[model samples]
Target: MRETLLLLSGFVLLSSSTNLDVLLHQSVPYSPQSASTEQAWIASLESTHTETKAQTTSTVEGERVHGSMTREMKRQYEIAAYRRTKAQARSTPTATPSPRVATLNPIFDKQDIEPEHRVIADQAFRIIPGHCQAFLKNFYVRYDNPQHRGLGGKSTIILTGSVPDEEFRALFFHELGHLTDLGCFQGTAVAGSTPYMDKDEQIWKDDPSVSFYQISWMNSQAHNRGTTEEDFVSGYASWDMFEDFAESFVYYVLHREVFARRAAENDALAAKYQWFQEHLPDLPKVAKSNTRWDGAIPWDITKLSYDWKPPTELVARR
Candidate 1:
């Protein structure tokens, strides 16, 4: 049976034979304006925090007494403390301050996910770069065969059913690649219409992804002038520029040495690899000792396994 791939702006039905491993639900075009607004909000929070700290210190000093209080004094102290607590609560924001300027925490709707699976999902989410993490807004766990291996879009990621931890992690990383492409790096907005149609090179010109897209794709459906599969990271990457980006992203992260070695042989592959290095210089890479450059390319790169670092706290960044 064929399944429909849901996009934020519209839906496109895919044949059963189509690789549905990674699907995107397009979200709002990311803009610097949003980041600036978040920066302003953060500054306000810092100011409020400073004021609250001073107020709390003063309150503590005032409340100190050498002797036991009488009934009247006790009642007044209780009221004052109650009022102070209320005031502080009102002033303080619920969201914790992050070191990064405009990063947002991914909200996990874990009601559908098994406890053990949720743990694995959390670990996978932490492995991606902080800039990509900022693009995620919601995460969901679901069970839908032939439809939901993994879906990312609308600032959300949805994982289908349970699988081995490593496989789950790899799948999540691929979905994150989608989020990173759509969210962190956005195309220019076309007037009076959506900007995500893969065929439109004009919208993509401002994006770093354009360089990668130009290497293998003239548009979304055609190859760039003379490029071919030899220039792509995997068979799956040949599907389109978006898939090319996501697949290349996963390869670069999970099998850096392998990707580099492959790049040495092909000029197109080398350009793609260099793009990642120049754009995401600080992205975490799987240790070289843990990866091997088997000349054979997996049709689905996300299914491969490499030594992944233990989960650490996710740091937010712009």
Candidate 2:
């Protein structure tokens, strides 16, 4: 009887780790919105390995501020600015209660982690290594319509545990880049410099059309250009400002010396790098040694999942 049970367990694990494509085809159908997000995520992933194709069909959602500026994106930016104000508020004794620690459900027991790898996870926005694809099975999503039920607030950093240190570092910053877009935190830092942006002026106050991303030279290959023409830190930065920030943030955080040297050559890149130094003043200079991203995660493109689904159901019943 014990042998039978052990066999059953092994089969379950094998199916999950190896049969993802089969599972996706048999699983819940993808909502258009969720599909779009999945496509964007996949594109971003592909960009790490190859030049990503332009996503002309992908639409940016928000109230139109001007040509491409949207109020929705501006609101996301406002949230980050608000977080700064809230951080300041917390400095006072009478400030509101601190936010609850971020919740995570990892397949590996935290009690089993070595001290060093655990530290790396915390610094990288509480990243938890697990089967990211299977994790999605727990949620329901409708991506195309905001009126349709879906998750809210949080974004995901999808990676398998076995990723190498360099790639893991890249993925960590990439997700943080998405978080920066939500205005959850300041997007820049310097070792000991003054705060990067105009504290008095809100970022959302400016016309979005005039932002640094509007520069004509920025494109899918922006990262490949010489420092003079490249406003982004890597090729992935060309995806969007959100991606640009994430790619740049990783470079700024992991390769501070390199970032500083390059910043000297480009005014726009310099300003972006300076934000991390000034705003996140206390961030450590480098990831701890012995950091291991060894957890394995299965991939499925069609699954409907999100980190934070709104409580209200947004879909209409037939």
Candidate 3:
């Protein structure tokens, strides 16, 4: 995602070019033009949230609220969000796309996917077509239940279902990496907080069986060229310690042989790989052909953004 920093109404808005910027621009206190827009957006969100609570809650006498109305309202909210996102995209100059027409890969719709390819997607992700768009322009997966937000056990991965099978599967594995951390394989903390920061290559420095020379040398070259932000696996991994572990986990799980070769050539990666091998002992090794996780998915999440409102047909709302 491309992040742009903006100074607006005495507030620093750090937003992804699409959803974040659209939703955030309205909240600037100094803009009268946006205040009304922001209020309407907030109202939509509140209304949906309120309805969700009403439908799910019971009175002291144990009577349920208006369930049908709640369902209807939810649908309205989804349509509203979809419309708002489109409106914002048209108005926001920065969001205009290049001349290239990116083909949207549909993950659902039985008529759309080939019979052979559609075999296990719904079984794996429990995707509900029409409830949500095939692709979320801004994010890969959204874990929405209070307990499941971000990476949590209670969370179900809400996929955009917009990419090709291989790309979608790669995203699935990446989220799986987040789930791994949520399960306790948290790799490292921020650099200043732990010795692991500078010791990625030397986590087992004193262990005679480990060799650090090759990875350390590689790290030095990377530092000189600014190719990697840290001694983690990839540039994206350098964003945060958690992401670092996730990136590494996906690589090791999917492309074991290739990752192993790379690990052997770099001590830091080897130690990280060793950590996963020990930490997630039961993690199955996948065939190289199955390792489709290569780069970040091309996210054009204009459809995923909302001026305000909860999705009406939310697949896993809580």
Candidate 4:
């Protein structure tokens, strides 16, 4: 039995097919909504809605104070004034919750992770049935060749007895990407249907010079000496959209420094800067103002990684 090195929590360990043991424990909670509080919330919502309508009427009437303005022009003026006033009112501003950074939980080495991560993990799990807090299965994915320990099949994820919280979360997200591909977590891509599986091989072939064997402009020792760019990069990229998706998510949420670096080099990253300007929730007004684009993603058309950008709309969302 070959012991493959795996990372769990932040600790590294060696394990093999025969010795790997996965504990099955999910930390899902059933925090049902309270009815009395819900009713109060509904009442509050109704009051706010009523006030909004009343304010709209008052603003419209106030605009009529100037008869010469056309209806559209008057509406624009009111909107602009309302926004200016609102902006001023919010001058002192409010602190926003930071984007949750996925951290390595040391307790996983001791098998003591709290339910907080499990809760977030479920969001990705909710995309797939028969998948819960974390899942494991020994099956091959298109990105990977068949291995003694892998993920595939109808149910359960395989764990090697020692899954650290952060690594576990990474693997959970990694597998979740596969689940996402299955239309389980994110899409309705029928198994073996989407054409994305071969995207990297196609891209690396198109640009063997830059991608094939470059050292991590970020890391000095990433590339092996004398490794041909075509072989190294082509193999490194490995039609693995799973890794791409995971890398993209990690860069977006945690390694934003890398995101910034990529955006500078690749036009696709620039497009993502613009795209994220429009989509990322909870950004400060200042950062929102910094994006130079409005309608399209800022990255270059060819180099933009799909994981870095949101999917283009295929059908009108009705």
Candidate 5:
């Protein structure tokens, strides 16, 4: 019986030793420093980062890539924005577009026809639809909210912001874009605002990566900026149709006009059309002419000489 007990004890000892070895050799790290495990994990992280950067670089490469990307994004944003405004218009349950054309209050409807003629006939003649009225945003009063009285009324679409006098007509063309977007003549209200700035390629190269996600992403990079008017600086870039249309309209206005200015200090503006042409692919050649963004109204290079004309009779204030 003593011998049997000794054999049994030996067997138990053997089993315990085997179990200890198994645990020590388990699948997880057994090394003293675990240096290999850490190295493998780091390698994985580096690979992932490299892949992501490569993807970013690949996405933004092509001919006129910058302009193409900007235009495509702006169009995408415009579609979505219009939808939002459509919803708002429906939600408000306001007045409908008159089936028949109605006369506008001259001051409210619009008093200045000269600017319209300039933008259409001289400036950005390529973009101006025939019989374009820098129509008033009169109907928008129902839905218009006083958010940013940056320069004018909540719905009041002013002709120019803080730009020089010579540029007001072109600038007015930009505001006209806001007017057009706000159902100025379409008789339909815009659903939302979409701000898209397409800076020159050289300009973008300095900062790099103006991704739409910077504006549209759930946690947009545009949301976090260092500025006193952070909301305007960040959200403004993506929020308002007024900005997008205005900027695009501005391109139509002063695109080659900048060249005209340089013609005095540098090369002829006409010669620079080729450079501008490289920027806009969708537009026609004639649309690219340097004179297109000019006007019948003589431009005062210093400041706006708009003599305060008496408000037109049609301009009946509500």
Candidate 6:
């Protein structure tokens, strides 16, 4: 048996054997300048104005109102105006901050990752929809864990070791699948073994993924309930619903037409394809590929072609 690592708060780990991903946690609260501080500043400016006005009245009473003002009074008036200007600037609302873009931060031991590999990884990242990509923070590429191909967390992805360019792309997409499942459709947390709510703010049980899960699994543990090998995209997917979603996600991206042909033969696959079409319609499609659905499903879908619609084409689609 593979060694099981414990799940950490705000992060999830994905191993070759199982997928244990989590929802993106809430961001740190941004505390603007306190209201009381603004009020205090305003009050101080008012006090200064009152004093300046009173001095001006007393000093100018027996002389010309503007020309007889003392140097100190002029300086005070200028300071008061400056303070008023600052207060107004502070109170003015700023434009909302733009969302953070996902970045690939390689923690490799030698930093010898090939330029072509980086391009492949970038292409895979762009393949994900823009909205879904917004939820991601960092894609860490590390060489420490050679055994695990990829791992995913709330708003992060970890691609381990190195493989062929196509395999690297696929592995990244597989982990991205986990990120999309957890982050993109993240909902409220509830009390139970199924802790997350779906996109509709209901329990995780009602999630659209659950609908796909129901096609093969009676529950997470009981797999012998009516579903057959043909029903799943790959043997790994049959392991559990999380893997099912992730594996199917890769298939939908790398082999959409092949998957569509297979889906025609199997109603279960057709439904899964439909699920992707309906729920994740914005994902980029493969522009060119020679992969066919006639053979047995490959255990690793990432080992396939790397061709996909470029970011420019994807933008046009939107």
Top candidate on lDDT is 1
The estimated TM-scores of all candidates read: 0.61, 0.36, 0.36, 0.28, 0.25, 0.59
What candidate 3 gets wrong by more than 4 Å, as runs, is: 1-156, 184-230, 289-318
lDDT of 1 by residue, 172-206 (tens): 77777777776777665543222335332244556
- List candidate 2 segments past 4 Å from native: 1-119, 126-153, 183-203, 206-229, 287-318
- Provide the lDDT at 28 for model 4: 15
Alpha-carbon shift of residue 126 in model 4 (angstroms): 8.0
If both were scored by lDDT, which would come out higher, candidate 1 or candidate 5? Answer: 1
Query: What are the per-residue Cα lDDT tens digits for candidate 6 across 1-318?
Result: 111222343323333233333332111111111111101112343344444453344322233445445678667666766787798999999886533333443321113445566556665666666787787765545444344466654476556545666667777777778777766765334522343232223446544466666666666556645678888888777766666778888888887888899999998889999999988887767545567777687665666674665556543332
Cα error of candidate 2 at position 51, Å: 72
For residues 57-143, what per-residue lDDT tens digits would candidate 2 score against the true structure?
Answer: 222333323333355755665676678679888896785643433333342114433333333444344322222223222212222
Q: After superposition, how far is residue 281 of candidate 3 from its true place, in Å?
A: 1.4
lDDT of 3 at 260: 72
Q: Rank the candidates by lDDT, best first.
A: 1, 6, 3, 2, 4, 5
Between candidates 4 and 6, the lDDT winner:
6
Off by over 4 Å in 5: 1-127, 130-134, 137-155, 159-163, 184-241, 256-318
Worst 10 residues of 5 by lDDT: 1-10
What does candidate 4 score on TM?
A: 0.28
- Model 2 residue 225 distance off true place after TM-score fit, in angstroms: 16
| Model 1, residue pairs in steric clash | none
Which has the higher lDDT value, candidate number 4 or candidate number 5? 4
Clashes of 2: 19
Assess each prediction's global lDDT (C-alpha) against the native. 0.60, 0.36, 0.37, 0.31, 0.29, 0.59
Q: Which stretches of candidate 4 lie over 4 Å from their true place?
A: 1-120, 123-161, 184-239, 268-318
TM-score (C-alpha) between model 6 and the true structure = 0.59
Best by TM-score: 1
